[model samples]
Target: MARQLDLVDFIVGLPMPVAASPQANPLDLLPRRPKAWERMVAHVPAEDVRISISTTWTRVVVEQLREDGCGDQLRANGSIVSHDVPPGLIWPEPCRLILMTATSAARIHKRWCLEEAPGTGLTNTFRFARQQHADRAAVSQQLRLLGEGQS
Candidate 1:
């Protein structure tokens, strides 16, 4: 039998680890950030177009872009980009919202593919999903509530 009084401890002990799925390398899934320049090019699709990118932090990718003379090209093309947009949002330009959305969707799909790349430890999403379900079930059993129905 289980008691409601044990809820605190059960809640505290949340996220029990399963033995089958060992901790994956943090580098195993190096999340790819969307290429702002390519996105702008595809969205605008012209011989010469100016685009402004706003971001919070100065990522290595951004630095590489500056080093690769993209800054000079953008300047010649009369485009200025800065990392100033709010979190979880594309560039704040109203005209580019739809294109940005499509680009964002594509970026997500690409990242998913990279995470599940062949020969990587993170390849088996099915196995990981099953392990997650099993872990959740074990936790639920350990924290079974008395006099309450479970879905």
Candidate 2:
């Protein structure tokens, strides 16, 4: 028959150019930078850290759902055309939209940047990753040296 869509998700998926589409969601400005995107990065409780969505426009979806009053038209002859990227929409960053007409669902994955993670004192995520790599290298070197010396 026809597919169903949630208004919230539909609104969130709309592209920029579409007149009926959603706004330029500030969430894409995740983890802010230069103190400009600070507000978007949220402080998850008891985590000692912050989290944000991607700034990259990887996941962007177009709307195909048409509403005539309270009901929405889901399928175009029970085919996938019911889920199309509302024509003439373009996002600033690179993005991809996936429409699975069989399920009538749209999924988006976009890129983003963060402001700071220092608020929780565990903001050294990158530093920690680098340090771990260095430490592993040192350990590997030590093990190789010990093996060579013993052999």
Per-residue lDDT over 11-125 for candidate 1, one digit per residue giving the tens place of the 0 to 100 score: 8779967668563432222223345544444433211221112222222222112221232122223343544334323212222211112222223223232111122122111
Per-residue lDDT over 1-151 for candidate 2, one digit per residue giving the tens place of the 0 to 100 score: 7977799889988886746543343334222232321222232111222221222313232212221212112232332233233333332211221122211110111212212233222221111121111234432343344334433
Model 1 steric clash pairs:
53-81, 54-82, 54-83, 54-84, 55-83, 55-84
**CA lDDT, candidate 1, residue 110:** 32
The C-alpha TM-scores of every prediction are 0.15, 0.16
Clashes of each: 6, 14
- What is each predicted model's overall lDDT from 0 to 1? 0.27, 0.26
- Compute the lDDT of residue 33 as modeled in candidate 1: 32
